[model samples]
Target: MATAKLKMSEVRGDVAVGVAQGGATVHALKLEGGKNVPLCPTRPKNGLRHMGLAHEQKPDLELCMKCSAIVPTGPVTVTKEQVSIPGLDRTVIRKVVRPVNDTDTTTEEEEAPVMAENTTTADPRDAQVEEIRASIERLPSLLEADNAEGAEELNGEIETAIAGLGGKGVAALRKTLRAERDKALAAGEEAKAAKTPSAEIVNLETKELDDNGKALIQKGIDKVKELAVNKFQGGHAIAEIVLDIRLGITTKNGYPDISADTDLGKKVGGALIFDDILAGLPEEGEDEASDAIRAEIGSIKKSARNAMQDVKVRYVRSLDNSPEEAKKFGYALEAHPDKKPSEAVFTFHGIQSLTRAEQAKQARELKAAEKEKTRLAIEAGELSEEEAEALSSDGEKSEKEKRTETSNKLKKTALKLISDVKGIEDEEEKDEALEALTVLFADLRKALTAK
Candidate 1:
């Protein structure tokens, strides 16, 4: 048997162009037999012979089989290459020849290419500095336009470009940039100030209280008396009044109650009444008492401060309301006695500070809670006695150990609370208690393990 010979004329499909394994560009003839015949151009002549066509010289031209016409396969026009060199006085430029097959066109051309100056050479550092200077000059306009992001990006570019440069030039440019930024900031603040209204707190003269105002003031006094009798010692009359006022327990007339039965309270009350009379006594030109209220309020506030040093008073208020309103009311309480009853109506509430005995009770409860927690953890086999003792010891423990102890305590509390819920006879009460306990336990667990 003889091997069959391959004929190019017998090839019957489309022709394709590809690069050879060695990186030579060649034409492949697709054959009816499903094989490719790669055709390489002859060297020196740079001509290809295929399908009976001989000595085809133009590399960029490919032959069309149907028309037998040569067509260009790539770009037709040739672009000239130029190089730019930035100088102090002017940019230097030079033109160089590039071959058609070079493919690399990375060098970007200037919008208006210019001839070079004879005295200068191309220096990249000079170009970088010029670019940085241009960016710095544009920053103020960018900021004024509120293009802060663009300004920041440009600033980074400028800094990076000037990082290698030294001496007064860089320093001067940096100073100019800082000045521009500061000016922009000042202008913004000035515009803001122009748009914002200034608040004026007027100290109005106190007017005589009407029937309603008197009744409200009496109510506030009664509330304070109740607080003092129940929680505070006799010596803490001033502190009690201040605390009551702070707590928003104003009289039905809206005036904060400053009345107390103690001697100190009597003295303070006299001063306050004097202040009120002076406030309402028809201004008749600023009376001494009008100015004296400032000193009086200040003195009372100082005494209240001293009282709080040894006591823990928690003032509860609406989340949406300002605490400052209550404070201002307290300051203006003396003027309340002189104001109309309607105008004297205000709200105040205060929780009395824990007494020494109460504090001891809380401490005992906390210790009992800790003991219960330790017992529960031991019973659950989650903690050993040795570990529990170490945790309870006076020796400093790591944060992890502290957290573990807290978690154990919270778990014990949760279990006890859950058990107690079962004893509630009312289904609704039991359900409510269980729901509240669940929420509390979840919150405590999160707190104990929080990073």
Candidate 2:
């Protein structure tokens, strides 16, 4: 005894059904006794039907058997239709629903129509192209501002973006950049070509000399050479010597004495005047001969000074008590009246061995004299006995002091032996002398330690 279910579309006009006032279509029966509700054709799920209602409208309520007293039971028909927009390239799907008589209970779906291909949706490469275009647009302003570094950096970004686009875009901008680069290169070349040649600058301190200055300098050089050969006998440097002689001949005003009537004065005046001229010439234009002469003089003076420093001088006892030793030693003698003839001093220059031997002998003599003086002072009560004992050595001396005294005596004896060996040309006699000196040194060492 179930009631027969029917769809709104399947219902015939002969069926007895309540229709709402003002010709509204009946959607469902109010079984409990209420007004019949009007049907919404757009809401198929509400089991409502209207033939003339717009298909764009949406369903207002959810349809269920519990809310409606009489539910429409029929097959649901779904139709997919393509709706094209006016400006857009692609079409949208419009889903239409229709009520149909249910001969079977299975659900059904309909395929939508194919749409025409268009570019309405966004392309994946569009963003990249926009970024490249923006970079390219910014490049011109950077170039105009003379921001080469900024422009280059921006250009690289633009190029990278364009390269990502497979080099299809930015042709005009690339041509512009190339034209600008060529213009800059041409302008640089033009500027370089138009530049004027500059004159060679001369230093104030070393400017070139004139012809008259050259002749004067050459004459001064000849005079210096002549002076070195005649006066210094080419044995000593001439620069300092010539400088002194020139200064002597010149007056306080730094000019030569040209008014002198004597021949020697005339020669000095000529030489000094030429020297003044040479000194006044610029250093840059100085003749090579003058430079060579100056260098030679400097070398000779340096060598002479070094030789003097290396010369060794020794003081020895005078054998004859005469001043002849002073002349032979190349030093003046110093008078010592209190000393004996054996103790009278003589000097030997440029003799290292003789100098060391004499120095050792003098040191030993001084020590002995001091000891004797200390003993005498104690006897006269001028010095305390304890002080005299301190001055004199004990029976056992310090090992260091004894060794030093022994070494000095040995050095003196060895120096004497070397001197004698040098005098003897025979090799065998020299060897014999050396052996004898060695034996004497051994004996001396023993005697010193015994004391």
Candidate 3:
């Protein structure tokens, strides 16, 4: 046999549950939309007659046992209550334990509630960057220990990191590695002074040519000097003279058996051209005269080269991107200390242009503004004097170093944007998005760099 007892259900919103009408017992289930459900057709009236209200009308409702058979099986609670003991003294008021069904009506929302969102989340990329920087920081110690294997591994890692960061202008980072490599390798290039051939060798070589050969040599030297003055105003720091003479073998097939086509090249800026003064010189021939002319031309080219070496003029470039032709005329090939590495100006004899003056003025203004800002910070207690001075010292790095740093940062950001844009399958949309990003970056740079 199974137990039978009344099971009341909590009511909610226009639906009465676990209350059987015209019957004492009720099941713990509700009817959908006030309609009869086959599981429990005798549901309570809507918001009208439930267990508590029915008990107030009729005290005998507590003993109702109508819908208990279809009630869902679950755990029952036990509690002590004052009741008469069975088979003991009549009307004895003794405490007895009795099983109780769960009658407390509480919604699920009242038991547990949702929690608020947590705001703190750590970004892992920042940690990766820090780890890479820490590795780089260990390089000096590794080099000091002469740990070649460790240094090599670290070098590879740093190179990979630099590539990921848009590698450019990072050649200086490998100086330590190069120094270690240099320990086991000897330099191949001889000193420039030690490599010079003796003048006697030149004389001996020239002796093989006739008077015509000597004249050709003098002609070539004169031509080099003339071009030097015309191009570089008496500067011959990096000019070279080139000559060529060709000869053909006997024409057994009777096609004029060509030989000795004399030609010369005007060498400038590492390029040889026949369009200059050395276009056509010695007449073509196959006999002894042609051989003699060829020897003469060779002598002339050699003599011209020697003269260029002796032309002693020192010139320096105002910037890295200065004209190459300027170097040929004894100008300094090094960039000026005061000029930016990216500037394209070329200067000789310490010449200063109007643009340079403006640049100097702006540089001074920037320095003054930086100084004032530091001073204000210190006075306002935003920074200590020591910290301000330390920052000023840091700003004292060379302009080229600063420019290279800025360029590398820009390149890194641009590369990331390019990589993202490349993922777009539509070519036209990619191009458009890339252009918009470029313009946006330009605007952002302008805004950030503004005074």
Per-residue lDDT value at 241 in model 2: 41
lDDT tens per residue, model 2, 20-50: 2222333332212111223222222122122
Model 1 weakest 10-residue run by lDDT: 110-119
Lowest lDDT block of 10, candidate 2:
111-120
Segments in model 3 whose C-alpha atoms lie over 4 Å from true places: 1-130, 133-451
Best candidate according to lDDT: 1
RMSD in Å for all candidates: 27.1, 42.5, 31.0
Provide TM-scores for the models: 0.23, 0.15, 0.15
The residue ranges of model 1 lying beyond 4 angstroms of the native Cα positions read 1-78, 81-83, 87-131, 134-157, 160-235, 239-357, 360-380, 383-451
lDDT values for all models: 0.45, 0.43, 0.40
lDDT at residue 321 of model 3 (Cα atoms): 45
Error in Å for residue 25 of model 1: 36
- TM-score, candidate number 2: 0.15
Candidate 2 vs candidate 3: which has greater lDDT? 2
Worst 10 residues of 3 by lDDT: 112-121
lDDT score, candidate 1? 0.45
